[model samples]
Target: MTCKRALTAYPELLSRTVAAPSWVMPGTVRDNAIFLSGEVDEVGLCFFETAACLAYGENDLPEHLADLPLGWHVHLPGDLPWCDGGAEAAVPALRLMDKVAFLGAHRAVLHPPVGFADGAARLVAFVRAWEAAGRNPEDLCLENIRGEDLTGLWRTLCDLGCKVCLDMGHVLSYGQYGLLSLPGLSGRTSMLHANAPGPGGRHLSLDTLDGAGCGVGRAMCALLPDDAVVMVEVFDWEGVRRSLPLLETWFAAQR
Candidate 1:
C-alpha cells in the first residue's frame, strides 16, 4: 500500500520535492531534478544559487517564474542564514520554510554546520522553532555529515524521531577516512544523497562527470527499496547531467 502519512513523492523525490521547495517558495520552473549542489566548484550553480533564494526576497519569487511545480525544495546551508548570530538565524529560515510551504515543497533537506557549537542543541533549537511555526518533525530532513565529529549525530537524530537523509558518498568518504560507517542504516532511512567523485579529492562538478562518487552511489541504491529519493548531490550542472544516467541505471536495476 502507498504511504499516505509518509511524504508524497515520485519515488525519485515524493520521488522527492515540493515539500522541500515549497518551504523556500522560489516558484522556479518546478522540475523533477533530484539534485543538490554547492559552490566549491560550479556544476549545479544555478540550482545552488536558486536554492539559495531562501535568503532572497519573496515577492519577486512568486512573480519571477512562470511555472512552479508542486514539489520543489532547496537544501539550505548549515548556518542557513549564514548571516549572523543564532537568534537571527530563525528569521530567514522561517521565511524560507514559509515560502516552501507557500510554493508547495515536500521536504527541506538540511545539514547541521560542519563545525557546530553543539549538534544536539542546534537540532533542538531548530525543531523548536519549526514547532513554534506549527511544522512537524517530519517536515525537516536532516542530512548526515561527511567530516569530523558527526558519526553519532545521525544516531542522535534517529533517537529524536527525526528523519534521516543519508549521503552515500559521504559515508564512503567518511569510511575511507575512518571517520564514519555505512552499517545499521539499511531501513531506517528517509532519503539518499549521491554523486560520483572526480579529481582533487573533491566531489566532481555535477556538470562534468569525473567519476569518483559512483562507488558509494551504486552501493546506496542497492541498499534501498529502488524507489527511494536519491538526490544526485553534485557541484554543478555537468555533474548533474552525467550522473543522471548512472542514477537511472540504479533505479532500473532494482528488484
Candidate 2:
C-alpha cells in the first residue's frame, strides 16, 4: 500500500510523521532521498557507512536537499570508534552533521558501542565531543541495539541529556523489553525505528511481525511523544510498501 493511502486511512498518523529509509533503492543517498521524498513524510538519510558517505562528498549531494518538502534526519554510522574515547569518531560524525546542516535535521540516530570496558564513559565522551562540536546533545538519539538494551548507560544518558531512538526490531528479536521501562523513556524518545528482524541480521517488513510483536510495537509507540518520528527502517522499497499499510493498521487499532 502507498503511504498516502495509509495516511488517508488513519489520519492520526499525521501527528507522528512516518519516514522511509534513504537506502530504499539501490542508489546513492541523494537518489533515494529524492525518490522517497514524494512517498513518505520524511527521509532517513542512512549514513550507516561512514567511509562511503564521506567518500561521496558533500558537494555531490543534491543541491536542493534542504529545499525538499520532505523532512530529513541522519542515521550516524554504526562503526564509530566509540571504544577509544570517541574523539576520533566524533570528527567524522560532526563533519557529516555539518554536511547535512542544510536539511535542518533535528534528530540523528546513533548505535552506542557495546562490550567495551568503559562503555559508559565512552558514551559520555562521545556526547561531550558532540557538544564540543556545538551540536545539541538532545539531537543525538542513542538507539537500542542487539546485545545492548541501553539500560547500562541509563544514568549517563540522563546526565548527558541525550535522547532515545527505540528500535522495535531489536526489541522483538533480542527480547529487549527492558527498554520499555527506562526511566522517563516516554519523554526522552524522539524517534522510533520500526521493523521486524529478518534472517541473517537484516531488517524485514513490519508486516512480518506477529501478534505479540505488534503488541510490543504498540506499547513502544504509545510511549513516544506526539511529534516523534517513526521510520520504517527497511532498506528496500518493497519492504516499505508492505509495512506502511501495516503501520497504518496498527495506528487504527490504537484508536
Candidate 3:
C-alpha cells in the first residue's frame, strides 16, 4: 500500500525533501523522473558512470529535463580522481554539470577517494577548480563511503565551503558514530543518503533496518537540517517504495 500520510502533513518534515534515485525503473532517466514525480519531492539524476552518462546526456538526453516538475540533483561519478588528478579532476565534473545545467540541480553528491595522503589539499584544489568554472562550491556534497568516513576530511570540507551528504548505512556498517558527534558538522550537512547495508554491503530498504540500525538512523535523522534532502538510496523501485513510508515514520518520530 502507498503511504497514507502525505509527507507534507508532518510539520517537522515539511521543510525537508524526500528523494528517490533516477534509475528506480528500467526505463530512461526521464521516464523514472516522471514516474517518481508523484511519489517524491525530488529525483536524483544519477550519473554513476561519468563517461557513459556524459555521452548519453550530450547526445540522447531529452530537451525537456528542465520541464520536469520536480527538484533535481546529481550523484556524480564515484570514480572521480580527487586523489591523483587534483584540480584537473574537476574537468569531468564540470562537463557533467554543464550537461545538466538546464535541470537546475540543487546539489551534487560525490564519493571522495579514500586513503590518499594530503586528501585535504587535493580536495581544496578540486574546489578551486570547480569555483573557477563558475560553479557553487557548496553544491558539491562529499558523501561518506564504506570503509572510510568523512572525519578525515571534515576540516577541509568546512574550509572549502562544501556540504556533507552523510550516508546513514556507512555510519552504521562502518561504526562511524563519532561522525554524528562532530562539532558543527550537522550545520553543514545538506543531504542524507538513507539506507541500510544488506549482505555483501549492498544497500537495503529502510524497512529492513534492525534495532541497532534504526537507532543509528534515528541519530542521523536528529542531525538533519530543516533544508536537507533525504535520499532513499536503495536502487530498485520495490525497495524504494517500501522505504518511503518507513522514512516518513522515521521523520514523524523526530517531532
Candidate 4:
C-alpha cells in the first residue's frame, strides 16, 4: 500500500527506515528513531541503534515512546559475524528483538546484513541467537542491499526461516537490478527504503521521487503479495513528500 495509506491502517503503521552501517550499532539509531518517530510515527534512524541497545545491556527498549503506541524498525547490528568477534552480543540482540515483539509493535523492519546470500549460513548464527532468546523466526525481517558481493545473505535468511525487507533504491542502484526477482516470498515481508532522484541516481531527500529509481520498486511489488509495509527510505522529508505519488501508483497496481 501507499506510504500515506499504510499509516492509515489498523493499529497504525508508520514509516522511516532505520539503517546501520558497520561504523555504528543498530540499537543506538533505533533508540533515536523511537525518540523521533515517537514524535511522528516514522522516525529516521541509522543502523547503529541495535548495537547501542546491546552495549547498554538494557532488557527493554528505550522507554522514550513507551507511553505512546509503539512502532519500531530495527536494523541488525554489526557486519560479517553481525556481533563482531563477540558472540556474547548475540544474546542481547535477540533479547532486544524479543522485547520489541513483546510490545506488540507494528513491525521491526530488519535490514538483513546483505553479506552474501540471504540464506542459511549467514543467518544461522543470528537465527540461533534469536530463537534461543524465545523469538519467533517470523518476528524478524532480513533486508536486501545494493552491490555485487552479496554472497550468501539471502541463503542464510532462508535457512533461518525469516522474511525480508526490500529496499527499492538499493535494488535500482544498477540497471540490471530489474533482473533480480523476489523468489519464495510470502506476505510476511514488509517495509522498504527509497529516495527521490534528480537524475544520475542522486539519492535525493525522501520527499521527492520523480520516478528516478523506480525499477526495483516495480520488481519488489511484483514479487510481494498484497498489504505489505512500504517504508520509503527517502533522504529527508522533502524527498518523502515527493515520492508519494509514485507510491500511490505502485499501490494502485496491487489492486
TM-score of each: 0.64, 0.93, 0.92, 0.64
Candidate 2 has a TM-score of 0.93
- Report the number of the highest-lDDT candidate: 2
Put down candidate 4 lDDT per residue, 1-255, tens digits, no spaces: 223332333222233332222112134433544434422344423334555554543433455544544344555554434434223445556555555553455344454444344334435666676677666677676655544312345555666677666665555554435325435654546555555434665556544433444544655656654455555554444445455556555555654
Q: Model 3: per-residue lDDT, tens digit, 11-113?
A: 4444568888998878888788767766778888888887788887532457776676678898999777665666877889888888887888757998876
Candidate 2 — which residues are off by over 4 angstroms?
A: 1-6, 58-60
- The lDDT of each candidate is 0.48, 0.83, 0.81, 0.48
lDDT (10s digit) by residue, model 1, range 111-139: 65455656466666666776677766665
Candidate 4 ranges beyond 4 A from true positions: 1-64, 78-89, 98-103, 106-120, 147-155, 174-179, 186-188, 196-203, 206-212
The local lDDT score (0 to 100) that residue 161 gets in candidate 1 is: 57
Best-to-worst lDDT order:
2, 3, 1, 4
- Candidate 1 Cα errors over 4 Å, as ranges: 1-55, 58-60, 63-67, 81-88, 114-117, 148-150, 176-184, 199-202, 205-213, 225-227
Give lDDT: candidate 1, residue 146: 54
Return the lDDT, model 2, position 88. Answer: 70
